[model samples]
Target: MDIYINKIHYPINNLGAGTRLGIWFQGCPIRCSGCVNRDTWEAGEEYRLDYEEFIRALLSFENLDSADGVTITGGEPFAQPRALLELAGFLRKRIKGDILVYSGYAYDELKKKYPDILKSIDVLISEPFIESAGDRLLWRGSDNQKIRLLSKKASAVYGRGIDRAEWKGRRMQFSIVGDSLYMIGIPGRGDMEKLYEVMKKRGIDFEHA
Candidate 1:
């Protein structure tokens, strides 16, 4: 099996509960409006890799074992349902950490269409990013999104939570992939503009950011 990917980033603290291995799958049918990750909207073979090779590449990172979990975001992970499940199987069987996913699919629809995949992961952040609803929740993009627990560990971390970030502590991180700079995180409103301004001061032109 092959996984079409946008990028894989690690030790990211803002996307999930802790430092995580972040995998951004390529292609999104959901295409929620005003999404900052427009770069990931198309399915491309540019970053395609054999599933086994991808697994090996991740394990090659020396610090991976220290990560709290693996976070799978997209490009709508379920858009490539088979590949997503295959990779999820591999990760769940081989790794010792939790597995998390973000999808634009409604929770009930996900259960109907991808129950097995849902059962494999520890956390799920679901529903499309509704730009108008304007959410400030932990690990969610919009007020309409749902953060669910598929494993005991998830409940332990997120139980009794409200739809607001602990401190409006929205954050993002930058990394280099194949000579291109990519960002990872859930940014708040206007945060990208501020980030662009900061990048400008450093001589990095990110006006589209």
Candidate 2:
């Protein structure tokens, strides 16, 4: 199996509970308006990697064991159901961490189309990014998105206070991977503009990814 990925990062604290391994898929059919990861919206040959190679690379990371979970975000992870399934299966077998997947497709729709996925992942953050819906939820881009706890572990970890009332604020983590700077996590409306303005004054120009 081969996977197309934008990048992979470890010890990601903003995307999920505790530290996590974050995998950014390289293609998205649901190119949501105001998506911060516009650079990940397209798939290309340059992003291709053999699935085994990817696993080997992950195993090589010395801090991989420190991660509390795995966050599979995209360009819409459900867009590649087969690879997603394989990746999830691998994680379930070897990683022991909770598997969380994000999708632009609604939960009900995904349950109908890719029912098998429910067995592989622990949590699902579903629904498209609605630019006008506003960012009022934790770990979500918009209020319309739904977080479904698909496994017992997820329920135990996230079931208690997973609602708007529990939303404190959106948090972001910055990491420099190779030559690109990744801004990980959901950012509220106007946040990017404010960040850009702040960076501009400091003479550091940034292009959105």
Candidate 3:
């Protein structure tokens, strides 16, 4: 539960309807090329907060109505999988919102190596950023990255596979408004305008507003 930092409105975390609490853990190992948070690449550089203290801070945000759920991001969340798993378990028992995690490791690899860790996460965004595949619209840096759904029991009972999407190297972004989807952060203003026209021509329900 010891978290690094929290942000109120974090566009860099995920696409969703509610306010997000972005927790940047204190370490990372990949040293990804052109990392946005280069400072996090080094471990043991930042001061650590006790687990209970971190949880207290997160709960404080609930009183302020400023956070919907916790987004556990890091130098690399999986780097400290046990600590994260424990934290997520505690949150699931007390909090009502979903848990989202971002990691440079692949989902399948994590599943094989640490299924217990995967069990605690609702959504896992995986894959390292490949500079060649970088696009402005994707959540992470590369086309190889994916948003994986990890509720195995639900998937098993529903008989429907977890939702997964691949980035096709398009400069398109997405936002969620109470389950409604909106595309944001398209590369150019002119291109976005043209895209709106094309969507209209194709009868796609889209608007710039």
Candidate 4:
């Protein structure tokens, strides 16, 4: 199996609780307005990676086992259900942490369409990003999206109450990979603009993804 990938980064703290490995899928069918990851909206052939190759790449990370969880975001993870199933299954077997996925599709839609895929995922943040809805919580892009604890592990880790478990403020992490600056996390309204200005003052030419 081949999966289209945008990039994979380890030890990402902004996407979920504790240190995590963040996998961003390369394609999104639902291109939500005001999305920060515009660069990942296309399903380009260059992003394809064989399943074995992908595993080898991940296993190469020396601290992979130390990660607290795995966050699967997009380009919309549900856009490629088969690949996601394979990826999530592999991660489930390889990591001790829970699996979290973000999607533009609603919970009911995903539950109906991809029950098998959801089996491998521990937590899900679902719903399309609504630009005008405004930001309201952590681990979400907008107010319309919801966090669902899908597995027993997730329920324990996140507690029975989702809102209480996610009371912290939203945050962003910056990483430099091969001369490209990758911004990881959910940014609030106007957050990117503020970051751009700050980076400019430091003489770094920053561009939004």
> Each prediction's Cα lDDT score?
0.81, 0.85, 0.60, 0.86
> Would you list the rank order by lDDT, best first?
4, 2, 1, 3
TM-score preference between candidates 2 and 3, better one: 2
For residues 1-209, write the lDDT of model 3, one tens digit per residue. Answer: 45543222244324322455566676778877655545566665254666787667666664323445566776687887767888879867765556777888877788898888778867777888666664543345566677666665324422233233423444444557575554432242245568678888999865332
Q: After superposition, how far is residue 75 of candidate 4 from its true place, in Å?
A: 0.8
TM per candidate: 0.89, 0.94, 0.64, 0.93
| Alpha-carbon shift of residue 167 in model 4 (angstroms) | 5.2
- After TM-score superposition, the amount by which residue 188's alpha carbon in candidate 1 deviates from its true location, in angstroms, is 0.9
Cα lDDT tens digits for candidate 2, 50-139: 988988987887766667889999888888889999888888887767899999998888999998887899988899999999677888
Candidate 3, poorest ten consecutive residues by summed lDDT: 157-166
lDDT per residue for candidate 4 within 82-126, as digits (tens), equals 889988889999999999999999888988999999888999989
Residue-by-residue lDDT tens digits, candidate 1, 1-209: 88888877878888776788888998888878889888888887786889889888877877677888889998888998898998888888876778889999899899999999998888888888988886667777677887777888777765646334453656768888676788777777777788778889999885342
Candidate with the larger lDDT of 2 and 4: 4
Overall local distance difference test of candidate 3: 0.60
